[model samples]
Target chain A: MDVLVYIEHLNGKIADVSFELLGKGRELANALGGKLDAALIDANSDLATQLGSADHVVCAVDASFAQFSPMAYKNALAAMVKERAPRVVLIGNTSMGMDLAAGVSAATGIPLIAYANHIAVRDGAVVATAMVYGGKLFAEAEPEGEQVIISALAGSFSADAGKGEGAPIVEIFAAPTGGAGTQFKQLIQPEAADVDITKQDILVSVGRGIQNADNLEVVQELADALGGALSASRPVVDNGWLPKARQVGKSGVSVKPKLYFAVGISGAPEHIEGMKDAATIIAINSDPNAPIFEVADYGIAADLFDIVPALTERIKSG
Target chain B: MNVVVCMRQVPDLVEELEINDAGNDLNREYLKYVVNEFDEWALEQALLLKEAHGGTVTAIGLDLPEMDNALFTALAKGADAAKKIEGDFANGVSSHTAAKLFAGALQAMPYDLILTGVQSAEDLDGQVGVLLATYLGLPHVTVVTGVEVSGIQATVRKEYAGGMMSEFTVSLPAVLGIQAAKQAPRYAPVSKVRAMMKEKKIEGLSSSDGAASSGIKVRRMFKPEGGQRAEMIEGDADAIAERVVSILKERGLVK
Candidate 1:
């Protein structure tokens, strides 16, 4: 195998990032003139059938593999990498992927480049463009080894390209056993919905620049004036100022509102992943170089404290 | 129980970062350095564990500029001991190299749990804790939000994407990449920190020479190309607000 894409799944459903990797994996495999393989752990034939873009589907089936056991999954993936010796392994740069990528690389002694947003074959060597400094800079990097592991960031490729109908070879093998140092108890789902930000046509989103929980009223007034709900970035949610339902990001609700009025939000890629598809984005931040400006349709490089209240009053009067 | 928390300083993002002449790294001469935010949470988690389970918390960091002040601050904030791993970190070390150095320095220490930040601005790889765990032959967990210890077992709360979370019971002698603590990290008074600087000492540990390279070589570093940049609605705050209202009205977002 030339390119191996790790298929990530939850609740028996394959993750979209896995499909995105498969799309990129197919392209890289074709460039190398080799086969693209998808590695599925404890997944059913139904899931395997969905991985038609890959030339082959390698499944490691075991009872313990049903749920994500970090140690077990790490050992199994490392073993597969050793056995297959694929030139490049593509894993989604997601929460689960972050847990496994470095461990697998260390176990197999293969160099890993993470946070990759763009990858290509150059001079017969795989080079990747990785996001650094919270997406403020891009680092073009190449691994120095026969085999390399690249954890591509989510939203880097198109999921539609990886979806199609084609029969690929399927192989099943028993997973390695007996490294159970941790036990998964239960998954805590998000709190019951207070207000679904996804259903709203307009959203007033705030970030760390909101300053304090008490300061949320400034942005709340804007959202009320616009006849929309208030949402926020991860920091605001993590700070306990906003409920999880009102958060927008990869780990929060993805919102595609008609108007995304951002105040004080610096657009990290994870935060951008959720709201980038908004119809019209307007951002207000003091930092002129904030990444949020890159995605906003209109922006004001001014203090949110000064602009937000004024905007709220203007909209309210009209 | 004994705990070790690894921390590092990163270039403060508040200041604009400029690439060095090498085209592969940041220009560090005028950069302000601060403790990596997630690592502060890791230290807080360690302190919490120590306070609950009766153990000593050891704060360890690479020998970078202003690291001693961070260590003293940690000591003032409740850490029992501090150690700085001496190494050639002038240009900064990759996560791979830092993991190796940390592993080397930790080989002789007695630790029931090792904690580190899940990721940093420089190390978006999020590799150190996991790689360090691999080197130490210990089980590791990442993105952990909270940890509760009883006897030799710890029940940890790990966060997944999309507001999902899971509980895991991990055995002792494990490594955890802490995402957040139960509460915000406590602040150390400047006066107490000054007392720690005067009364306490940070032990120095030497890093092994010629630590193996991380293998991934940066060819170049550059700012991201602007993609459909937002049209600037400049001037004072009032003008900006008026323009925003007009845009919203034009788009029919508001009447």
Candidate 2:
């Protein structure tokens, strides 16, 4: 049986999260000894080519797929699974993925597992690591069924080396019609500067230690040198030194990057839970005993003002 | 510009959540409930919206008999009015159920916009906004950190992974799951706190006849356990690099 993976997009470009699911879906597909088909609701065929490769691409582009209508998406996905008869459907942990996964699983009367930090196949069953205890705990569950719905968290999946002998075979299928159950009467948006923070590999994150709003420029200078974006702690956002858009906490966005430099960050549980996963975490704080160092790959117990500008100048001059 | 902000009374997040009975449920012996920190921020978002656009902020939640203190917490956090669905619905009125209950409550006097935190502190499901939208039949957007409201609609900037921002605009009478979004949450003013004490306009919604059981059932809650065998890399930068390379090879996380 074929496994379906949900692909999320923004203005025609497949979201980076969709690819992450693909990266994990490939592993699960190989483990289950089945074909992997990526599902794009209201998307085009060229996305399959741009995606590099997939066993198959299911398109559900209709007037209904134009906007994210959860009811409509669930209807479309459930119908697809019935027709294709896939064993496991993979989805990202993002909004569309979370929304579609739950609804799809529930509507089809199949067990749905989500935010699967990790999943390993063994003993004729899929042991999926799902988040519990509010991102603090992980559980390995094996849903007793021929078909399973699962996902891998963002940044956990690495890009495939494409190491296997043959590349992924591409197959295209049409999305069958189901009652478009959901409707999007309107789109409400928040007011803020819209910038792409995902493309940058380097991020300079500051926490409560900055003390004042003016100190932000010190962090910004380094971010500029490295072509990275500036993010901050919850206090900074709370005080309006930076917008909530820049905040890095569990309640905010989870950032995974090649290098994240944390300045003045105390490394609280949830805040650390969000950013400590960065490939390289360089923490510079006055308190040598700050908890941020516990998870930092590189720890500098120095005044950030002295260290930040020097680092920026060094990188610039180099 | 009236808005209904949904809040949850959850275990204090700073306190370590351990399964005292050796299963999924938290031990109430050491537990004290506070408004889910993010949902507090969501109520803060509603207050800010009301302050700017001029409207009423109604706070809604399901409170146990022991949780009358939660009503004050919501009121102190700047909800103009408060409503509690009295029942034990931790599992029954799940996130989806909460959304459905709100939808049913709002069908009569739907707010111009409904605001929620991206996820509750306890459940952290992050699904209610979209689920509520599906039932309310309104447009839904999540991870919102910034908002600009016009008549009957608003524009929002949402946070994507890696701290990126995506902008979308939707008409009002819709559902929005707000993030901190840089609209600094206002602290409780002495006057506002004083006024909230006397200003009592709380309401209770009926969750009978399957309103509590309209969604999926969680069969069991499993305990989490794992330990990583660390391969520490300590030396000069060069030596550490070599050790890291070897470790990566061993773990198969790298080539």
Best by TM-score: 1
- Candidate 2 true-interface contact recovery: 0.08
- Classified by CAPRI criteria, candidate 1 counts as medium
| lDDT by residue for model 1 (A1-318), tens | 389999998888899999999998988998888999999887355589899898899988876677776777888888898899999999987778987899888888889898888999998889999878777788999887667899887888999989867999998856686545877778889788788889999899999899889999999989999999999998787667888788898778788999998999988777888898999999988888888888899988888999999988898889
DockQ (CA atoms), all models: 0.75, 0.16
Q: What is candidate 2's TM-score against the reference? A: 0.71
lDDT per residue (tens digit) for residues A138-211 in model 2: 44555656777764455556545211233444554455553333244444343464544444577888887898
**Model 1, residue A119: C-alpha shift (Å):** 1.3
The worst-scoring run of ten residues by lDDT in candidate 1 chain A lies at: A173-182
What proportion of true contacts does candidate 1 retain? 0.76
Candidate 1 structure quality by residue, lDDT tens digits, B148-220: 8888888888877768887888888899998888777899999999999999999999997666578888889
Q: Estimate each model's TM-score.
A: 0.97, 0.71
